[model samples]
Target: MAHPRQADLAGLIDALQAEGVEFIVVGGASAVLHGALAMTQDLDVVHRLTPENVARLATVLEGLDAFVREPAQRRLRPQAAHLSSGGQLNLLTSLGPLDLLGRLHDGRGYDELLAHSEVLTDGIHQVRVVDLPTLIEIKTTAGRAKDRIVVPMLLALLRERERH
Candidate 1:
């Protein structure tokens, strides 16, 4: 199925925050929020693994009309069971691509990363976003070509932020 040219990241963030889902925005979106010029097609979040949070996440997923991005024909809707499992779920929602991760590539989860995150408000919703240092650490550790290319830019952003 063809997706929207761009993901409605704010809408997705609003939905998750509205539902009281415990999550921390990470990856490219987080980098962008931190003033990086990186572009992301999906909103990646690391959610708390508690049963209640999982249920809430499942509800939000259902409300968003989310389904497994792969096997486009199947269109499998994610369940609480899926959310509880510690891994990643690449989903296509009405808002666009939403990747719910149980943990990061280096095995960091919501609880672990929470201390390194900050709650930012755009005079609207208050969302927790991973710090640039942590984001840089994760991306650099991943070492994928795409991730590698962004590290330098993120480093520059971090340096610029430090100068202020």
Candidate 2:
């Protein structure tokens, strides 16, 4: 069977939603959803790690042919046990680079982020994307150069959202 293009992030989102995986689209993708002009090669998601939710996530990962993205361990397939234990999973998948985060830098989980998220459509499924302000917080806390570059843009988007 054919697979989605490597850059087809929306296809991954649609699949995750279909599998009932509880996740919040965050990082650069969330910023883009809120109207920021930015480009990201990966989809960053914070997922709920409840055993049931992790099971659903594993099912999706299996369908996507997901495996660890790290160079040395790229062949290792994701297992439910590992996903359920949950920290961060950076996987190169048939769909794309899917970053599954179990907790935020500040230790917030999926439920917390979901409480503050909005459902945004990927031209297919209504995906839960983290709010702009929260996205900014995550980026700032992370303090990576790439994230720093986008902080101002996210702040501007937040302001723009507030004014409208």
Candidate 3:
């Protein structure tokens, strides 16, 4: 199995946006976009579970040549059924690693998160990213060691954002 040597997070987001896939950037990627000094190996997103959105996401995934990044030997490709199953999928694609989540650990899905998200544009593409406070709440609630490590930094960034 060929591992993704470098993750092209921007490219991944571009691809998703191009296909009209409705998803909200979450986890470490959201923190980074919000100016937090955090490092992440994959682009984590919470996708809308509608049939139309799933179809678009599947198309993008196919274009990316995505495959399940587990049990190295099996090399499973995800289908629309899997995409709409309200589950998490960790995939390795030509562009990079991508984590497609149907819902957050705290049971917040795309609809729930959309209200707390904001759209950011870089001239060409507009990407939706979860806000700092929401991201911090997610990380804090996650209670993982890595999540905990980043909470303080995220909080500091939040404070800075508020001041400016």
Candidate 4:
């Protein structure tokens, strides 16, 4: 029952990149960065699915003292295999909730997402954030109630970006 305080996204991004864990920032965080005017407590990243990358991610997770968020597996520690498995991992780290997605719907991985991403620099650290169009595609495909709720906002943001 250890509820660690949420770590700032900059710190998390710096840590992950410092560890050489290849990933792309996605979900609500990306939306907000792309001017969607949304809020997200958790950081969602689509990590690369290579053994070396997974190993790197595992190292970063270990350093963060990350554990599974699921009640049934809260005590279970994450492993490199989890990253290599190509799915989503809901984890709670000393920093905060971090969702590591190995792939998105229909098995789109880092390479695919990265192709449609933009590098965002926060003065200290730089990370690839999914572009607004692709993020909209992802949200539309996800089709969850939460994902659906943000589509219009994202579309509006996209239109605004296009106008400028």
Q: RMSD in angstroms, candidate 3?
A: 1.4
Q: Kindly give the stretch of ten consecutive residues in candidate 1 with the minimal lDDT sum.
A: 1-10
Higher-TM-score candidate of 2 and 4: 4
lDDT of each: 0.89, 0.83, 0.90, 0.85
- Please identify model 1 stretches exceeding 4 Å from their true place: 1-5
Tens digit per residue, CA lDDT, model 2, 1-164: 23332447778888998999989999888887788898988888999989889989989999888888876243788888778655888888888788888888788888888878888875756878987777888899999999999999988878887899
lDDT (10s digit) by residue, model 1, range 1-164: 35664689999998998999999999889988777788999999999999999999998988888999888679998988889988999999989999999988788899999999998777766789998888899998889898998999999988988999
Q: Worst lDDT window (10 residues) for model 4? A: 1-10
Off by over 4 Å in 4: 5-7, 72-74
User: Could you estimate the TM-score for every candidate?
Assistant: 0.94, 0.90, 0.94, 0.91
Rank order by lDDT, top first?
Answer: 3, 1, 4, 2
> Tell me, what's the RMSD of every candidate?
1.5, 2.3, 1.4, 1.9
**lDDT for residue 161 in candidate 3, whole number 0-100:** 82
Model 2 root-mean-square deviation = 2.3
lDDT of 3 by residue, 47-163 (tens): 999999999999999888899988646879999988998889999999889999999887889999999999977677678999889999999999999999999999999898899
lDDT value, residue 107 of candidate 2: 81
TM-score of 4: 0.91
- Best candidate, lDDT: 3
Between prediction 1 and prediction 2, the one with superior TM-score is: 1
What is the lDDT, from 0 to 100, of the residue 40 in candidate 1?
Answer: 95
